[model samples]
Target: MPSTTAISVRNVSKKFRLFASPKERLMEALHPFRKQYHREFWALRDVSFEVGRGETVGILGRNGSGKSTLLQIICSVMRATQGEAHVNGRISALLELGAGFNPEFTGRDNVILNGAIMGFSRKEMLRKLSEIEAFADIGEFFDQPVKTYSSGMFVRVAFAAAIHVDPDILVVDEALAVGDARFQRKCLLQIEKIRTSGAAVIFVSHSLETITSLCSRAIILENGIILADGEPKIVAEQYLAILFSESKGEPNLDITNERVVGSSANQGIQINQLRDEQFCDVDPSAWAGSLSERFGYNRHEVRTTNGCAMILDYLVAGNGCDDISGVWSGNAIAILVKVHFSADVNQPIIGFELKTDKGVTIAGSNTFLAKTQLQPAARGDTKIYRIEFNTPLNEGDYFVDLGVAEYDGSPGGYVLDVRRSMMHLMIRRKQEKPFFNGIVDIGFRFTEVDC
Candidate 1:
């Protein structure tokens, strides 16, 4: 292993034997023919990857996709049937709830025990006990048996101990999911510190938001194989594609390419066609067949429809242009979505969201939340929905997602059609003055005040 590499796995594979019953195993053992009584199940196959110091790599996959198995091999909780994993330094792994803690031991003792297991001396662990306990903030539970702790308390103590150990490599596997929102935020901040301190972090979580936001790199595993590995955003997109295709019974990751039906843009039409509500009212029933040819249209957009409705066309208009490629910060923009319902629909809802290019959702809203009522629709019915919002965003390229669904009394309702990353909006600042520095401008006012 290179000096800079904290962890490396080369062609690692793990296999397990399955038998119908214990009797089958006994029979196979007694038979002189030595016939096999169990079939082989490969949990991981030829999985290889390396994590360098200061790099945070996220492992993403559905359940039974070898995620946990691969982590176990790296953490030495389980052995690989083939190949090996090398670690350049001590590892602090929070692979599962109560994984390292002894249920019978007090939380304080467990921390010391874990420190000792990681090669720390009793005096060293004693010195760090106060800090760990303060971070955990589990109150009296620190002196109580770990079995008395709740799920949330377990994560708090486990995460506190794991990070305080100062290992060269940190392995976390979905253990933070049990933490409360406040604690999760605290843990993420600490993880960021660990990452900056030059520790290699192998983080496994089903939360795509966290994966995209925190990890420097990402890997996708499927069926004991590495499906995709690279930049976090791209890998996340591919992972979503796989999930969507599988759920729809499609075996391939072919993105939906259904052409937008609309009238063509007139020859020599500018990309920023100034449009707003009046433009939409002029011809509600007319198909803007050429909307796809507009200058601001995103060719790489992903669209999904469930046969109930289809988003026929869309346009972004702002600052005196109907089709705008960019909007000035703090300016108001209108998004027009033309939809065609193929079947009778009741209480349909339309939603809109704004996101950063890295896939972080900045803001989103739906008709249900606004308590807006729409008339029921029949087959062949067509309507145009308009969403208007102010762009208090920093200068950068952003994306807009439009979705149509039913208000089925569920938290998310039922999605009928979705156009993700379909509309690209560029937020521009006046060249003379750049107002904000980050992803958003929260309208901060500065004034001198006496303390």
Candidate 2:
């Protein structure tokens, strides 16, 4: 069934005014100048989308891409010069640190104040006060003014209060990015709880991993317009494609910067359709062009990859099946390999490997693991093989590597790593259960007792 729309935005546009200089503003204040010495900046333009109830949507873009402006508009912190935004329920907005906070007031006072701003009743805030205190972990710092709190403390206290207030919609900006790692994880847990209650979430972040993991759909904005809005994987891929296209992306090959991903290994291969003979392990450096030029390995950040080979194919099912992509966690899918024999090759080692988008292999099985004929044929002959398993991936991106080699390992194998795209799948929780969200669904047994 289609989810119900909880939030709707139609042709929303926001613009800001900037003064040419202090002198211009002073003159304008002293006496209205006939010609205004200011320029108008449009942060957002004609953006429209509907978010379903319980949907977690991510807004991703480069800095100054209007992501923050969009969030602020949704939260109603800033007014749009034109267009419309309808927020249907109570909101928990974790906007910039202390946007609604009193700088000179104690954290405790601000918690109460911010909670009220979120539409929490005085009695309700009192009841959830302990929960906020526990989650925030600010200790005595809660007694001090918010201005005295560190960036970490500011976010923790603010986030804890925002979520614990029982909001029907949540808006998170990049504020959480300032907190330490441990605190970030804690904040995610809280957000997860809120999402399970059928709340709408609008998360804005530059962190692709977080967006891909937590959201079902993602929006990529550039300048003041929406670049793309669809599946998380495709949107992220589109972003990657544009971020590091051949002509204009990541430095070609010789990335002396240690930040480059897969910098050390020459993992050169473009992920096209998959075949058995396609797997060839060759030095990426030895490939046709620069690694950076050939593939998009720009900006080596964690959760980003540098050099890696991968494969893509139609994941099949049924007795004789062929299907791939759009599979979710807990779904069973088959790995179908088309083995092509050339060079009078005899028995070709056919195998498959699955890796995190970061290039870490979590699962791999080959003809060696199964200890079978793998496959054998004369020149120009091709055959098919199959492997099936349960996919227990956490919500994120994954790549599959395919290969074929000789047992002697004389570099006699052709390993083609046309890495599969990072996969994005949603895992829905069961009804009437204590809800949770994360990788792997751990099936648990519970018995109810009636007295």
Candidate 3:
């Protein structure tokens, strides 16, 4: 049996008129008379891709790289300036929250309207209304006008409606970022259910984790062009590499450099080995971990019943034994990460990325897939997550990258904790053998025991 093709977008492109003067737009519209539009802004340039039934595909790009424009065109919320798009079934879109909503109408009213536009009948809407309400969790406020609702409520209701409509094709654009943690996970689970139910999906998101976890394939977009389209990890890694490569040339000059000031510094008293180590070890405490590359831009912004807590004090230690940062090239080492949790977080996973002195991500790993959190940690709670690996890194200065998240099998729901630049480790070459292949010598093993 062959899979059905659900969507086809051929050479789709969109262009907008840019006017140097505000009057130019007015003048051009009034034309019978010609106008003075200075330039044309091509939001999308001949972008073409196809989606198969039951397949989830991700479109990734920078802030203004046409991902949204492509989605809007395919979902029929907007028309293409050139080329054509074809969809084989009823389409549901979460392109923008409250997009087709009438603010004057109550949330309950718009829920039915949006579902009806999605091809659901009033009876069908009523049938799924409970499911939508359960997902939204907005309470009696559902009877209030949507315009008065919060951003969170708007997205919750919108996502509930989109999924409840049961369209044959679903187009989701970063709507996962809309609500709180529990809801985000709930949304991802629903998306998974939808995909499994045979609805073709076109998902656009910056969260590579989400893309890789939910979609069978991923595509990268740059400057309104398809940069790469292939496996999720390969595409996500490439995106991260390019993102850091861009971070190297110009360290956001305008952005204030927020240092991980040790607890002692803040408390006005030098306590804990961390403050002491910072003074002695030129590298900060954040770099105390053996693998730091995994944590690059790995910060999580976690919200709990109490509040939010930023995970800090990442310490990586090797078998060199004592210091979390202590490790010599060619020696057995254990990578350890210590994080301070501010609130109760369930199933928090920790990992690291190893970066060379030049900001190249060498290798990284997290317990997310391999293992699960042993316990839920609360405010002022600290835990150590450790991974042991044979010494494989070259002798050089390297940065440690860290990440923390409530492990939901899908990637989009991660609440970034912290991406700090404090931890730095120096590996001294093994005395007898200084052979360096690249960043790490991933020791491959071969055992010759009789079977």
Candidate 4:
């Protein structure tokens, strides 16, 4: 292993035996022929990977896809049946709820016990005790036995202990999912700090949003095999494709690579610069065939349709233009979508959402949420929807996702057609020294008052 490499696995594989009954096992064990009576299940098959120091790698897979198995092997909780895994530094793992803790020990005592297991002196643990307690924020429970703690409290203390150990490699296996939203965010931020501190982090989660936003690299595992590994966004898309196929019980593993469906002839023309009135004046026939020919189109857009309806075109407009080259923070912007239906439909809904380049959705809304009533549409009918909302976003590049669905008496409804990240644009600060410090500008006011 190289000096910069924190973890390396070569041809790692694990196997388990399943026996139906103890009589069959005893017969097989006592037989002179030593006949096999158990079926073999391979949890991992020749899986190999390398994690350079400071790299955050996310592992995504369906349940029982060897994600936890890989982490367990790396953490030395389980031995691999074949192959070898090398680690260059101490490891801190939160592989499961209350994994390394003694259920009889109090939360405070458990931290001290974990410290000793990691070769830390009791004095050192005591020095870090306050920080862990503050981060966990489970008041009173810190003095109570861990067995009495709720699942959320369990994770808080577990995560707090894991992160404070100063391990060279951190392995987290869906433990953060047990925490509430606020605590989950806190853990993610702490993970970022650890990654930046030159620790290799192995994260496993089913949430694509968390994976993309946090990991610099991602890996997809299917049936104990490494299927896709590379850019977080691309790997996430592949994972989604596999999940969709599995949901339908399809045998074929057909993955579609979607490309930007526009042209380069109009490259010099910035679409967002067009005036709103001009957009209103243009005939649908003028742009229907050339939507991909326009500028500002996202090359990674993924489109899926149910053959009932289709979105022909869309535009983003704000700040005195029908389309926006750039939107200013705290300004009003309108998303216009033109959709056509090929079959009779009742209560069609149109919606759009804004997402960061990393795929974190900032805001989204639909006509149903807005309580807009729409008439039923016959075959070969078309309609345009104008969705306007204020932009309270900080300066950053964002993607726009649009969808048209028919009401199916469900929260998500039935997706007739949906476009993922179809539009790309930047949000700029309207003035220097903007008040917001994060992705969103929720609007805060302050005033000096006499004491």
Best by TM-score: 1
Q: Where's the lowest-lDDT run of ten residues in candidate 1?
A: 251-260
lDDT of 1 by residue, 1-451 (tens): 8999999999999999999999999998899999999999999999998999999999999888999999999989999999999999989999878798999999999999999999999999999999999999999999999999999999999999999998899999999998899999999999999999999999999887799789999999988888878888657655654553313222233222111224232211123333334345525454554454343456577888898988877777776657655666788988888878888888889998899888999999888888787788777888888899998888666888889887799744688899898776666665565566777787788899999
lDDT, candidate 2, equals: 0.65
Cα deviation at 108, candidate 2, in Å, is 1.6
Please give the distance, in angstroms, between residue 367's alpha carbon in candidate 2 and its true position after superposition. 28
What's model 2's lDDT at 252?
27
Order of quality (lDDT) = 1, 4, 3, 2
Specify the poorest-scoring 10-residue window by lDDT in model 4. 264-273
Global local distance difference test of model 3: 0.68
Off by over 4 Å in 1: 247-451
* Global lDDT of each candidate: 0.81, 0.65, 0.68, 0.80
| Tens digits of lDDT, candidate 4, 1-451 | 8999999999999998878998888888998988999889999999999999999999999898889998999988999999999999999999888788999999999999999999999999999999999999999999999999999999999999999999999999999887999999999999999999999999999887799889999998888889888988657655654653313322233322232226432221123333334444345566543354333456468999989998877667666545443566777888778777889888898888889878999988887888886788777887778888887887666788999889988755799999998877666553455566779876688899999
Candidate 3 local lDDT, residue 80: 94
- Candidate 3: minimum summed lDDT over ten consecutive residues — where? 264-273
Give lDDT tens digits, candidate 3, residues 1-451: 1348899988988998788888877877788857556688888878888889898998877788888888888888789999899998888899876688899999899999988777778998898888888888999989899999998999999988888887789898887786898888888899889999999988888776588778898988776777678876556645543453324322221131222244322221111232324322323344444222222223222223223444434444443223333355766655545566776777777666667767788777676665544577776676666666565677555666656766676642365464534455545454566465677777656799998
After superposition, candidate 4 runs with Cα above 4 Å error: 246-255, 258-451
